[model samples]
Each structure stands twice: as structure tokens, then as C-alpha cells.
Target: MRLRSLEGRLTLLLALAALTGALVYIGVTEWPLPQAFAWMQEAMGRHASVFQPSRVDIFVICALVLLPLCWWLGHIVMDPVKRLLRALESAVASYRDGDFSISIALNRRDELGDLIHMHNELGQTLREQRQNLAQRELLLDTVVQNTPVALVLTDAGDRVAYANIAARHLFNEGRTLNGLHFATLIADAPEALRKAIEGTEDALFSVEMDGSEETFHLSQRAFRLQGRPHRLQLFRRMTRELSRQEVAAWKRVIRVVSHELNNSLAPISSLAHSGAELARRGDVQRLPGVFATIGERARHLHGFIDGYARFAKLPAPRIAAIEWKPFLDALALHCRFQLQGNAPSQPGWFDPVQIEQVLINLIKNAHESGSAPEGVTLGLNVVGHELRIEVADRGPGMSEAVLAQALLPFYSTKRSGTGLGLALAREISEAHGGRIALANREDGGLRVTLVLPQSATAS
Candidate 1:
């Protein structure tokens, strides 16, 4: 056993004293040397009467001889125990001061050494855990502070527990938000928080703050932290996304309404002009020709209206698995008249009817943009998992102003154009989970690329 402090020292001293007493009694009462010496003395003094030693003298001599032997035995027993006690005391002192470097010195293979080894191992583990926790906390703080989106954490009762800097600025306007109720911080927060807390369903919802036109998309999720329920409210600004969607919807509406109005107005305007010209000329014989011109313009205007109507009322695609090679072949056959003598260097791959319409619109736009000798180049390629179909023209690309409003309905750069072809193509591509992008080609031309996902080949 190990010992420490004054109490341990006293106990060790008492134990040593008891051991000394027992050793002294065994030496005096059970020594075989006294019997053997007495027998030798009797034999030597057999013919003469010898003097006998007193009991007191014998006791003193025995005491003097055994004293040193007892001291040596005590030293032998106490020395190792004292060293072990001192080592234990030092170890305990270091542990109390939070220093784990101190270790017990073991001179022999024993249980005490095994215990010290295990204690050191546990200390190492605790130190490592502390470091890891510190790092994780630092990382979490960085994310919470630097993220653009507002983050709020709530307890099981729907009380606000933590709010990040962004969230605080958003709800409290640089004021303190800690300990504030979740309902009080948000303008329409009560209903939103109630929906998250009372409802068991997990969902994403948008909430617009009252008095302010700010919209926030809120996603509620319930989870357990340390066996306690925690609800996280992740807020994202939806003003831009919603605005873009609204603009697109408005464009669609305008395209449909404009087409309908133009259909009626164009025919009426042409007929009225023709009738006035016939009366001014005073030529009854030319009246039929004027009427014919009116009819032709009216038919042309009807065709334009029909095109716009088709774009506005485009039906949802009935998606089907199709062989890309055969589809492209059919598209080429359908557009053979437009292609004339031009053939692509590489084979094209796409859906036939849908892609043909896209190609026709693009080619028609290209034809209107410029004349021959600087003709349009239609290119198709499969890059990675996307099929890129590009219609590039050698004519001057669109100006910045026109480029900006190119896809908007009723926005046209050409004098005699309806400006619905590119918009229709964009709508179709978006419906198919694809995109169409316009850019100026490097060689002073316009490049329109239609990017579509490639269907997987069946095994």
C-alpha cells in the first residue's frame, strides 16, 4: 500500500513499531542459541562449581544485541513503502493541478503499476476529447456567423434558444434577440411558429412579414440533441426567386393577350386602309386588287396570331423513351427543305418533333438576321451527358440592350418581327428540364445553344 501526508506517516510509524515489538518477543522467547550455549558451558565446567550470571545482566545483554537487528529489519520494511507513498503523493498533486504528465515509477511488475498506466491512458483520452470539442465548436461558430441565410434554433416548447448574427439583424434590426420569444421577433412570427410547433408534418413554407414586403422561406425540422427536442428554423430570402417567377408568368400572359388582340386589329386595319385607297383612286376596276391585298394581309396576321397562341398554350410534354438516332433522322427529313444543300459535319441526336420545332425557329431567326455569303452554321455535339445543339451566325450579334430584353414577350429587335420565337424555344426547353442560352460567338456572330440531357442507353 502507498501512503501520503502526516496521517499516512503516523500510520506507517505505528505499523513499524508493532512489527519491532513482535520481532523482539520472538528473538527473546524462541531463540535456540541460548539452549545450545548452556549445554556447551555445562560440559566445560563439569568437574568445577561455576558462577551463575544474574537475570538482569542476561536481559541487558540480550536487549543490546537485538536492538541493531530490529533497527535493520525496520529500515528494510519502511524504506520501499516510504518511496511508494512519496510517488503517489506527487501523482495526486499533479492530477489536482490538471497536469497529466506526472507518472508513477514502477520498479516491479505489480497491480499498482497497472492502475497507474490505466489512469494515464484515461487522462490522454480526456485531453484529446477536449481538443476535438474545441475544434468542432470553432467550426460551428464560423458557419453560424458567416452564413448569408438566417438561422434560428428553438427549444422543444418553441422558445428561442439561439439566433445567429444574420437572424438577429433580420428580425431585431441590430437589437438583442436573446431570450426573446420566437413569436414576438417576427412580424407574422406567431402563426409561422405555431404551424411549426403544433404540426407534426415536416414541410417548407414561405412567410411574408407584415408591414414590410420581405419574404422568407422557412423550413422546419425536429431533431433530438442530448435526448431533448430541438427545432431548427432555416430562413432563406425568396424575394428574388418569386419576382423572377412573377415576371415570367406576366410575360406569358402578355404574349397570349397580344396575339389575340393583333389577330383582330391587323385584319380590320388592313381592310379599312384598302377601302379608303379604293375610294381615293376612284378606280372601280382596281377595287378587286385592293380587296385581295386586304385578304392576304389578314391571312398573314391570322397566321402570326396562331403561332403566338400555340406558344402561349403549349401543352405539358408527354415524355416517352425514344431512340435518339432515329429521332434525329426524322428531324433532318422534316427540315430537309430548310437545310437545302447544307449538311452538318457530325450526326445530330435529339427528339424528332420537339427538336425540329426548336431548330426551325432558330434557323428562321438566323435567316432573318443576315443574308448569304455569311450564312448561319448549325452545329450539334454530345459533350459528357448533355447534347448541345448550337445555331451560330456570321451576322452581327445582338446589342447589349436587345440581348437583355431578347427573351421578354413582345420585345423585338427586328422591324417586322413578332419576337416570340426565342421565347417559345426557351419555354419549351425549360419545360423539358433544359435551358437555352444566347451569347456572342468569338468570330463576330450570335451563338444560341440548346443544352439538353442525354437519355441513357438501355443494356
Candidate 2:
């Protein structure tokens, strides 16, 4: 048998031990040891073999020699196993301490060697996993650290657990914010910012620093992290964004007003010149017609200017309980629309004059949309604590691009449209604690819905 294997080496060592023990027993019990002792005694001037060993003495001698020999052979056979156990114990301890770099290498054609190889493979796998985890953590930290939005994470006790670079600069002049009380950190902050942070809702607040005002949007979220409740707050600067939007809105207004004024003034200018020329030529018959035309143009321009004035100075709504039948009947007298559903018997609380004006504009827009008079529909329904009024028409729906800006002031698709119809309606809706929504019908056409709370009051 090959002695390279653990089983083979152990069996060989045991057999060799047995064989040696048997030989020693025979020599001590049956060999010529007693005769040799007697010759030694004659040489030493003794008459008899006085040193002859007994059966028990021979047995003791054999036992002593065999025990030591067997022990030595066992040590040779099992020393590697004992050493392998110690190494494994040490490796396990290292792994428990999160050190996966340690590996064991041993050369042997035995079970112990196979075990060592497996242990090395496990260590390699663990090391690779730890390295990958570290890389992911590094990437995540880099992204969080460099983001422009200020981020702060607070533990359940309201102490700062983590803060990004932007947050540090914002609250503490770029100093680390770990373990600081959140309330105390903002103690020196502006009142608006402090209120926004302490409030239970997301908000936009402005802070003036060194003679410049900066606007910021604050968003907060609460959730569990690492088995403990934590809150995350994000602050995004919006000063430049708001400024850009304000500039764009002013440009749009200027463009629209200039175009309208040019259109009116150019015609009026030409008419005034024609009238003067006719008067100078003593063409009295044509002068009167020219003067009449000029008057009409002036009136049209006056009415256009008046529309903007009313939009800018709209009065607050005087809320009152409104009965549906009388309101719808009055509305029908002003515009053409087919009532789609029965109006709720529940009294609606809003300014009747303002609401009537809003509905008139909506119905007027519906008719102007090129839908047949019968195809224009007005619907009213009470849903929970709100009043919903929908105006739908069987006309071409607005494109996505137009729909996005349709509610904006001075935005229109019509050639002569003032563009204040929908904008005015939206302003009134919000003033009454309501909102407006526009959407396309599934089959065709567009639908505009005005939602107002039933309990609306003057504000």
C-alpha cells in the first residue's frame, strides 16, 4: 500500500509497532539471555547464574520497551493532524474578526491537506466579496459627498448622524456636523429657514446672507435605518432657478403687449392719416367714414386694455350658498351648452358672481373651439366635499406642447385670443381654495374641469 495516504501511513505504523513488540517478547522470554548471564557470572568469579530474570520481570521489560516505541510511532503518524487543528482554530478566529486575507498552505497527500485547500478557497472567496463591498461603499460615498443638494440624516434623538459636504457648509461653515443637535445647529439661522425646518411639512424659504437673498426648497423624510428610526432632510437652492423663470415670464409679457399695441396703433395711425388727408382735400363725404372707422378702432383698443385691467385687479370672492337651478338657468342665458348631468341639490358655497364669470369664459371657449353647439357639454357634480364642474367639447384636442403652457397667462392658440380666459379662470379657482385640470377625451376633444371646495369662503 502507498504510505502517502493518511490511512495507509497509520496502518503501517500500527503494524510495525505490533511486530516489534512480538520480537521483543520472544527475545526476553525464550532467548539464551539466562545462559549469557551465567557466562557473565563465571567471568566475574560467580559459581551460579544469580542474575536470571523471572517471568514477571521479562513481562515488565517487554511492556516498558513496547509502550515507548508505540508512543513514538503514534507521534510520528498524528503530529500533522494536531498541527492542522491548531491552524484551523487560528483561521476561524481571524475570520470572526473580519480578516479574510489569511490562507493555509500544506503539502500532503491526505485528508488534512484537502481540508486546508478548501479553507484556502473559502478565504479567497471571502476576500473577493469584502473587496467588492468596499468598492461599492466607496462609490456611494463619493456620490453622496459631491451632490449639490444639502443632505442631513438625524437619529431618533434628533442629533445629526450624517451630513454631506454641502450640508456642512450650509449649517456650520464647512465643519463636520456629526453628533450635533439639529435644533441647536440651526439656532443662528434665519427665522424663515428655522420655521421651515421645524415645521411638519415641506416648504420653500428665503434667507438673506451678505445682502443677497437665497431661496431654498426643503424636503424631509422619516424612515428606519440600521434598525433605528432616522430622518433625512434635503435642501436644494432655487434662487437662480426662480430668477431665470421670472425673467422668462417678463419677456413673454413684454412680447405679447408689444405685439398687441403695434397691431392697434399701426391701424389707428393709418386711419388718422387718411382722415386728415381727406379733410385737407375737402372730401367731407369720405372724411366722416374715415373718422367713424378710427372711432371703432379706438374702442376696440380700449376694450382690450380694459380686459388686462380687470384681470390685474380682480376683487376677492364674496362667498354665499348658491342654488343650482337658478345658477344654471342664468348661465344658459349667457352661453350655449347642453347640461350633461343633474346638478347636486347640495348648496355650493362660493362667490356666485365670480363663479358665473369663470363658467361663462369656459363655455365661451368651448363654443369657440369649433364644436357644434350640441356637442359642447357642461357637467356639474358634487364629489365628497367638493363641487366639480366640467366643460367638454367635441373638437380637436390640444397638442402636448400647447397643453403644457395653455394655463399660463397670455398663452393662446387663437389668432385674436387675449389668452387670459383660462388664466383668469385658474386664478379664481385657486382663490376659492380649488384647482383646475385640463385633459383630452379618450375618443376626441378636450375637457376642462374646475374643482372647488364646497366649504369655500372669502379669503
Best-fitting candidate, scored by lDDT: 2
lDDT by residue (1-459, candidate 2, tens digit) is 666778888888888988998888877776666666767888978655366788899988998999899889988977999988888899999999999988886887777888899999999999999999999999989999999999999999999999999999999999999999999989989999999999877899999977999999999999999899999999999999999989987888788778888888898899999888888898888887778888887898888889888999999989888888999889889999999978777777889999999999998888888888898999988887888899999989889999999999889898888889999999999899899999999988899999998873411
RMSD (Å) of each candidate, 1 decimal: 13.8, 9.3
TM-score of 1: 0.46
Model 2, TM vs. native: 0.67
Q: Each model's TM-score? A: 0.46, 0.67
Candidate 2: residue 83 lDDT (0-100): 88
lDDT of all predictions:
0.69, 0.89
Candidate 1 structure quality by residue, lDDT tens digits, 102-197 = 766564434445665676676677678868988999999999877878888887776778888888887788676667777655545546645754
